[model samples]
Target: MSLTDQLMTDMKVAMKGHDKVGLSVIRMLKSALMNKKIEVGHDLTTTEEQQVVVSQMKQQKDSLVEFQNGHRDDLVAQTKEQMAVLDKYMPQQLSESAIRQLVQQTATDIGAESKADFGKLMKAVMAKTKSQADGSVVNQIVKEVLS
Candidate 1:
């Protein structure tokens, strides 16, 4: 099933099971997906759908950090729960080792040997990994590999 379909199914289950957190997360994601589709004026591809989920996850992470730094334990716990719900929609994340290896291979393939080639190397690796890898982690690995 497509992400929307899956969300719809999960939404119904959440409602039936009285899972407030799960239901809220599902609705938020569904809304974001709908907004993206409207903005693009076309149906979203699988990659686009994944991008929306990733974007939502990033927002949640940022909120999580803020809550933690502000010492809002209650908010922190709630944000963590929301993040967990969001995680279910994401593609399997790449391990750091896997990402490091990919960075090395991509750098070799692109002949990127210096910091100047960082952009090229990053672009190539991200394309290969798609939504599977976090950009920040990939960025760190790319810098380490290039330097």
Candidate 2:
């Protein structure tokens, strides 16, 4: 099923089960998807949908960290739950070692030799990795390999 269809199905189930957090997260995701569609004036492709989910997951993780830092356990828990819901839609993330290896290999493959070539290397790496790896991790790996 498409992510939207799966989300609709889960939302219905949540409604039937009176699952507050589940329902809320589904609604938030749906809203984000719809907004993307509106913003682009076109339906999202499979890749676009995945990108949206990844972006939302990243935002949720950031929020969770801020909440924890502020001593807002309730918000932190809520954000964590939302992240869990979103993660169901994302592919399993690559491990740190795997990401590092991919970054090094990509830089090598593209003949990226220094910090000046980082932009080129990053473009190639992101094209290959997409949502499977975090950008921050990829950047660190690229920097390490180049240095």
Candidate 3:
């Protein structure tokens, strides 16, 4: 089944199991998936669905950072739970060493020898690495490799 379908199924199970937090997060995810479908006036491809899931995961990561900074351990824990749920739906994430290797290859493939070529190299690298690695982490890797 597709990611969206799996999410819908899990939503039902969460509700039946009386999992409040899980239900809420799954509901929000379903709503986001539906919204994208509505925007495009059609169902999303697996890639599009993955993109939406990844976007939600990114938001949770940001929220976790803010919640921790604000000393809201409760919120931080909640966000972390949601993030873990989100991660299960994603493909295997690249290790740091793998990402660094990809960054180097991407730079070489694009002939990016200097900082001026950073943008070009990053575009290609992110195309391959998106959803597998965080943007900020990817950016730092690109900078280090290119520098």
Number of the top candidate by TM-score? 1
Question: Residues 1-147, candidate 1, lDDT per residue (tens digit)?
Answer: 999999999999999999999999999999999999999999999999999999999999999999999999999999999999999999889899999998999898889999999999999999999898899999999999999
In terms of TM-score, how similar is model 2 to the real structure? Answer: 0.91
Model 2: lDDT equals 0.88
The RMSD (Cα, Å) of candidate 1 is 1.1
Mind giving the per-residue lDDT tens digits that candidate 3 earns over 1-147?
988778879988988999887888888888998999999999898878878888898899889889999999999988888877777777667899999999998887889999999899889998998677778889999999888
Evaluate residue 50 in candidate 2 and report its C-alpha lDDT on the 0 to 100 scale: 85
The local distance difference test score of each candidate is: 0.96, 0.88, 0.86
Best-to-worst order by lDDT is: 1, 2, 3
Q: After best superposition, candidate 1 residue 35: deviation in angstroms?
A: 0.7
List runs of model 3 lying over 4 Å from the truth.
none
Summarize candidate 2's per-residue lDDT along 1-147 as a digit string, tens digits.
Answer: 899999999999999999898898889889999999999999899888888888898899889889999999999888888888778888678899998888888877889898999899988988998788889888888888888
What is model 2's C-alpha RMSD?
1.5
Better of 1 and 3 by TM-score: 1
Candidate 3 global TM-score: 0.91
Look at candidate 2 and give me any clashing residue pairs.
Answer: none
Report clash pairs, candidate 1.
none
